[model samples]
Target: MKNRKHIVICEDAKTRITINRKWCKGCEICVEFCPQKTLLMEGDKAVVRDIASCNRCMLCELRCPDFAIEVSEGTGR
Candidate 1:
């Protein structure tokens, strides 16, 4: 199977967050650092549990040591 990818468009509709399950080691660093509590641990991977609650804060992306999370600004698909 291909690498699992979890993508969430923020409430603003301009920001997107992507969690690369293949790269995530499920360390929970991102989840703990997220000021908006937008991510959660699902089994051994991190997933976007709440998209609308996301505040465009890149803490998850910035704090992920595995480089598993990414936050971008654009009109997402």
Candidate 2:
């Protein structure tokens, strides 16, 4: 199967969260590390649960061992 990617733009449009379903191994590291509970597990993939609550902390991206999650700044402004 092709690698599926999920992207979420924060409410302020200042932060972007990307989740690579193919690279993810269903490990809850990102979900558990998210301080704002911004990430959740959907079946076996990590998904953005609350973009409004995201504070651009990047904990989920940093804690992901598989490098499946990425938190980026800017909205191409």
Q: Which candidate is the best by TM-score?
A: 2
Model 1: per-residue Cα lDDT over 1-77, one tens digit each: 45333433333467677666667898999888888888888798887787778877787877789987888874655
Lowest summed lDDT over 10 consecutive residues: which window, candidate 1?
3-12
- Angstrom error of the Cα, residue 33, model 2: value is 1.6
Q: For residues 28-69, could you state the per-residue lDDT of candidate 2 as single tens digits?
A: 988888889988898998888877688888778777899878
Question: Candidate 2: lDDT over CA atoms?
Answer: 0.76
Q: What are the runs in model 1 whose C-alpha is more than 4 Å off?
A: 1-12
RMSD of each: 3.2, 3.2
Which residue pairs in model 1 clash with each other? none
Candidate of highest lDDT: 2
Q: What is the lDDT of residue 73 in candidate 1?
A: 76
